[model samples]
Target: MANYKPDLSCQNKFISVNFSEQIQLGTFEYALYYIVENKLDLSGSYAWYDKTGAVTYPPSGMLKIILLGYAHGLISSRRIARLTKQVFTL
Candidate 1:
């Protein structure tokens, strides 16, 4: 067996968020997230045999954020991607 040790410097290098303050009831984002999780079935659309490695978020999550961005008049791909991270992280 190989020995392992924790890195002390990286222990404090993390960002924290307050989920209760970020997601509120009756909000569009919350509603969309709720529908995506509880109401919609997206597993059928995901690939099963793909070997693309790990993704930051699932494909369905990216699609939902992109669609939401488009609905809000965001046409640029970069902008959409940035907004997707921001909105999802919150």
Candidate 2:
């Protein structure tokens, strides 16, 4: 099983969003998230990291973010970063 970042959706944060509710079924984001989480074979990605040092974000999560940015035509890394901040910000 892959180690994933903690799911903090229910935490009382400054900006809270129930992603499952926000992303409706049959949508592109929904499909992307589902496919990456369930269908992809990410075992190879785990080989790159040893059980030491700082824990990095999962490949599946990174892939989802990048693909979503590309789908929205945000090619620049800076733009994508900004977009993500805006998205999670209040």
Candidate 3:
């Protein structure tokens, strides 16, 4: 076997930033991408920021969570919310 690795082995090499991928899931992923890019407010924009004080992922956190919900078929935001809690509770 060759003692080498593929070009995509780098951490940032896998994502395509073209914004033109025609896949069905592209819209969902792109939505989250732009939300973070522009630093736009998210669903919990009205919430008070706890200790860290930066709106606590106030940009694409919800979008990212919702996208993960869609990817894993978590139809309810309540369920997705639970996932977020569980993840951090680890």
- Model 1 accuracy (lDDT, Cα): 0.61
Locate the minimum summed-lDDT window of 10 residues in model 1. Answer: 1-10
**Candidate 2 residue pairs in clash (backbone atoms < 3 Å):** none
Index of the highest-lDDT prediction: 2
| Top TM-score prediction, candidate number | 2
Cα lDDT for residue 61, candidate 3: 49
Candidate 3 stretches with Cα past 4 Å from truth are 1-57
Q: For model 1, how does the per-residue alpha-carbon lDDT over 1-90 read when each residue is reduced to its tens digit?
A: 112233222232354644435778998877876787688777665544254544334545666667778878999989998876686455
> On a 0 to 100 scale, what is the lDDT of residue 87 in model 3?
64
Give stretches of model 2 more than 4 Å off: 1-4, 9-14
**Which residue pairs collide in model 3, if any?**
none
Task: Please provide, for model 3 over 24-47, each residue's C-alpha lDDT reduced to its tens digit, 9 standing for 90 to 100.
Answer: 355756655655547665435434
lDDT at 68, model 2: 98
User: lDDT for every model?
Assistant: 0.61, 0.78, 0.53
